[model samples]
Target: MRKIYVIGIGAGDPDHLTLQAAKAIGRTNVFFLIDKGEAKQSLVDLRERIIRAYSHPHKRIVEGRDPDRDRTPADYTGTIADWRHRRSQVFEELISEHLREDEIGAFLVWGDPSLYDSTIAILDEILERGEATFEYEVIPGISSVSALAAKHRVGLNRVGQPFQITTGRRLAEGWPEGVDDVVVMLDAQQAFTAHPEAEIYWGAYVSTEDELLASGRVADVAEEIVKTRAEARERHGWIMDTYLLRRRPTTDD
Candidate 1:
């Protein structure tokens, strides 16, 4: 039987790789890589560096073309579902062809596999089709949310209060009910700008050398954040940022 590992590689820093993750890499016979093109080559380079640092000498790497999707689609949910289905097909083919029975293969995921990542779902989809057969395991790693809070030295939620983790799209829709502390991810719209009263602890490429951090009331720092985010995105041709927005207690509260 074939065995697969869905290993979380943490955010971006090489040091983010855990001992367990390294051990998994060492035991892996083949690594499946999805090429996201030249603009995001840094991601591929980082993975290569880790594989070189910890993988066995006989390890093999197989690359697959990442399926393209609209960055801003009219129907975001449906678009993502379609994109993921296409992506699963790609992974299915890669596993069926490159991975041999009785060998261990891995997909190195960014951040924890159970977060906003789709690797696990894709694997499940492949299995459901009765096509690819394998035993899979998930290895957790530090997420960008964890890295952001650690770098800023702020707790995600104030004592005993709950914090909600949500996407930028939902944050833009409105502040979530009953949660004053909200963590936002995959926010291309700069949704934090909408809440001028909230205090934001923001970081881009957290834990990496090119990391940037900012904090203050959104009213005071929203412009700066917008400008900086634009510049960073332009500089890297892509950006991954996460932030915590803590709304102050209002007079009514």
Candidate 2:
């Protein structure tokens, strides 16, 4: 039977690769990657660095074109479902055409496969379709959530309080009910301002050479963050950021 390994390469930094992740890469017979286009060459280069640092010199590397999706779809949920299915088809074709029986192929995910990444979902769909058969394992790696908090030297959760992790779209509706601590990821719009009273610890390109950090009351640092974020994104063609927002700790607590 063919085998696959879904390995997290970590956020924007080759050094974030764990020993287990390295070992998994070293043992891979083939490394499968999604070509995210030229705008994200930095992402590709970082993935290359990981392979160079570990894998066998002659090991095979396969690149599959990542499916493109409509950024402004009329039906968001429907569009996402269609996009995911498209991606599953692409992955299935890659495995069926390129990977051989008994050979181990691996996909290097951006962060932990179990997080917001879609590799696991696509792979599961491929298996479910029965067009191919393969065994796979998930090797966890450090996520931007961890890297962001680490860079800021802040804890994700406050004492005796539960935190929520959500996206910018959901946050735009309003602050989560009864949640004092919230970690927002994939927020390009700077929605942290919704709670002006909150303190935010934000990081971009975390753990990488272009790392940027900002922490202060949202009202104080929001504009700076927006400016910095825009500059970074316009300069690099993309950005991966995460933030932890907490209702400012008061002496009364």
Candidate 3:
């Protein structure tokens, strides 16, 4: 039997790599890094830099490409299912080719794998289909939300108050009801505009050398965020950003 370690690399910063994560990298016999095409080269480069910094002498690096999805399709769920299946296939192929008995293979995930990442899920699906079998372990890392909160010097949730974490798509479709604070990620649509009345603490390229930080009333800064995000994405060729929104308390409430 083989062992597979799914380690979180944190949010784009080398410093965020936990000691355990570094140790995992060193111990693993094979490392698999996913490439999502040129639009996300920064991610690939960051992973490579981390591997070079911490990997053991004998560890093999295997680069894998995730399959592209057809965005023209009207069926969103179907598209995602197909994409996931393709991604699983790619990973399964890599694991089959490189996995050795009693040797550990690892995948370095961005941020925490337990968060929005689907890598573990896809791997599980492959196992369910009986395509692969390996003992798996997930090592958590500091999430973007934690980094964002630290940068802003604000608690994610008020004392005794609950908060929610959601994607940009959900914010755009409809703001979740009754949440005081919401952490939003994967925001390509400038979803802050949907919640014009909330206060926002936004950061782009967070924890990186070229980080951009902005905070203000959402309505007041939505346009600025849109413009800044566009410029940053163009300048850097890639950007990974996260933000927090707090619905301001009304005088009546």
TM-score of each: 0.98, 0.96, 0.94
lDDT per residue, candidate 3, 151-211, as tens digits? Answer: 9999998766778999887888887877778999988888888788899999987788888
lDDT of 2 by residue, 1-253 (tens): 9899999888877888999999989988888888889999888788888998899987888888888999877897999989999989888888888888888899988878888888888888888888799999999989999888888888888777778999887788788887788899989677898788889999998989999999999999999999999999999999988999889544333
Q: What is the C-alpha RMSD of each candidate to the true structure, in Å?
A: 1.4, 1.6, 1.8
Question: Which pairs clash (backbone N, Cα, C closer than 3 Å) in model 3?
Answer: none
- Judging by TM-score against the true structure, name the best candidate: 1
- Give per-residue CA lDDT, model 1, range 8-120, as digits (tens): 99998889989999999999999999999999988988999999999999999999999999999999999999999999999999999999999999999998999999999
Model 3 residue 148 CA deviation (Å) reads: 0.7
Q: Which stretches of candidate 3 lie over 4 Å from their true place?
A: 71-73, 250-253
| Ranking according to TM-score, highest score first | 1, 2, 3
